[model samples]
Target: MDFQLTDDQRALKAGVRELLAARFGRERLRAAVDEGPRLDRALWRELGEAGFFALRLPEAEGGVGLGLPEAVLAFEEAGRVLLPGPLIATHLAAGVVDGAATGETVVTAVDGGGLVEWLAEADVVRGEATGAEPLRSVDPLTPLHRVPVSGGAGLADVRPMGSTGALPTAPLTSLFTAAEQLGTAARACETAVQHARTREQFGQPIGAFQAVKHLCAQMLVRVELARAAVYAAAVTADPVDIAAARLLADEAAVRGARDCLQVHGGMGFTWESDVHLCLKRAWTRTQRTGSATESEELLAADLVSGVGR
Candidate 1:
């Protein structure tokens, strides 16, 4: 299978990036951070108009008539900007829930881990969120709530009301989450390299130092590896492939952010810089949909069973 993005796909990716850069630049990002966990309805509607949530829906249904690859590309851009909202849920709800495709409605779901993101702000909740306890999230943008697990059934097992009977399957859900992680990893790599080239120490650019150079190099390597895995999984849409991609992406995002911080030295730790926010977002994403432990276990099971043979 050709993993290279087609011209149209590249255009779509570029369009999303440009749209986001125009809508949510650095100043807007800091503004969102200051405002705290509120959803921007106008921005959400704009995203809807841009076909972000409807990327996977059939054109006959007023969507972009695209597939997972396109959806992944759009979401990767979202991840780069750290766009705050229940984006995945809204995207999944496009055809099934009214106004979701147009971004007039906000949707959120409980993951297999029983965590609901942006629960209070959602126009629709796709799981049993009864008795949900709000948890303090490491990412200032992603507010979380935990639903009580009952009868050994996960909250994700509960059927959503007023829509399709089932939520997204774990593999697809995890794949999209991996795509977002890939974006964060790539962004961290870029941020680190830019800083390394410009920031000076000891009367020389810090990038000239072997230690700083190595950190930046490792971040690039991790991001590239994760990107390959994520793009491949998006094309394949296989459970095993998605699991592996999620693992690699989680590592890349978390480790890349830390490496970025290391490259920035003390400045990365300051709230004034976006490096720390990337790290926090990466940390938050690791627990979403499929956690690292869960993905690892799934892959281990597949290997032991010779499923890939």
Candidate 2:
């Protein structure tokens, strides 16, 4: 299968990136950080107008009528900017929930671990989030609520393309989560490289140092590998492939952010720097949908059963 993106796909990805940069630039991101937990309804509506949530919906239903690959591309851009809110949930809810396609309705769901993100702000909660206790999230941008873990009944809105798990929701959720992870990983790599070229130490750029070079190189390798896995999984839509993509993407995001931080040295630890935010968001995203352990378990099971073949 050809891995190269078509012209239209490239255009779509670039358009989303440009839109996000214009709307949620660094200044706006910092402002959002200072403002506390609140969704920018206007920005959300603009994304809706851009067909962000309705990317995969059928044209007959007033959608962009694209496939999962296109949606993944769009979401990768979203992750790059660390766009907050229940993006994946709202996108999944586009056709099912009223006004979701238009970004007028917010939707959230209880994860397998019984956590709901942006629950209070949601116009529709996909799973049972009853008796949820708010948790002080590590990522300030993401406010979280926890419910007691139980055998979660599947939500009606989950449109399963081909899920390997007993619950049909994992395929799209895992794939899209991986796509977001890929974005963060790519952004972290870029940030590290940019800083390495400019920031100096010992009268020369730090990127000249072997340690910094190795870190940035490792980040790039991880990002590329994860990107390939994510794009491939988007095309294949196989459970095992998606599981592998999630595993790789999660590692790339978390580890790449850490490596990026390492390159920034003391500045990365400061609150004013966006580097820390990327790390925190990457950590938080790891817990969403299919966690690393869950993906590993699914892969192990597939290997033992030869189900992937």
Candidate 3:
């Protein structure tokens, strides 16, 4: 299949990028990191106004009537900017309630793993099971609580963090998360490459060094490979494909952050540097929504059983 984005998708990415560059710039992002666990509400509302929260909903639901492809593009931009929030949950809710297009509602999911704390932000929380209780969230920007449920309630509560549940909407959310990871990995790679090219060592550009060059090249490879998987999974909407995408995207996110840090050397480790933030965000996100190990195991089981084929 031709993987090229259409003119519309390109425009969508550009628009979102421009908006984030202006509104969610580094200063705002730092403030959120220092003072809040998630992103700023005003900025999120602005995104909502931009129809980002409603892009995947049907026209009848007051959405742009787009599909996962469009949603992925928007989310990729979100990842690029490290735009925070229970974004996946909100979008999943939008898909279910059919009201996200207008930003009038908030929806989140519950899984077998635990109850998510951020459900407090939702107008409605959906899940197969419930194990919820009120709890304080480390990320001040998102309000989280706990809930308790029996059997496969699909949601659970883990303090300082959010709950995890088997989302009825897991496939789509997984694909979306993969897209976000792809964006993060891509941005980290870009940042690393830019730094390497400009930062000199031993009277030569660091990027000219074989080790630095190799690291950047590897980061690019992971990002591109994961991007392909993520886009394929988004288009196909297959569980196996989605799992594959998640696995690849997780690797990209984790590895890309590490490689970016390596390229930056000591500077990457500093609090002022964005590399650590990227790493922390990627690490946190990978575990949530779903576990990387779980996805890999599922993929392995599918492959062994000839299911993924």
Whole-model Cα lDDT of every candidate shown, in order: 0.86, 0.88, 0.74
TM of each candidate vs. truth: 0.95, 0.95, 0.85
Question: Number of clashing residue pairs in every model?
Answer: 0, 0, 31
Return whichever of 2 and 3 wins on lDDT.
2
> Could you tell me the lDDT of residue 24 within candidate 2?
91
RMSD of 1: 2.4
Q: Candidate 1, TM-score vs. the true structure?
A: 0.95
Please, what are the lDDT tens digits per residue for candidate 2 over residues 171-196? 78878999999999999999999999
Which residue segments of model 1 deviate by more than 4 Å? 151-168
> Candidate 1: lDDT of 31?
96
Residue 167's C-alpha lDDT in candidate 1? 28
lDDT of 3 at 3: 83
Per-residue CA lDDT of candidate 1, range 194-238, in tens? 999999889999999999999988988888888889899888777
Q: Which residue pairs does candidate 2 place in steric collision?
A: none
Give one digit per residue, the lDDT tens place, for model 3 in 1-309: 678888998999899999999998889878877875543456656777898877766677666777778888888888888777777777665545555444556556664355463565666676643446755653344455544645335533311111112324656666777888898899999999999999998999999999899999999999999988888877877778888888888899889999999899999988889888778767756755556887888788887895545
Over all chains combined, what TM-score does candidate 3 have?
0.85
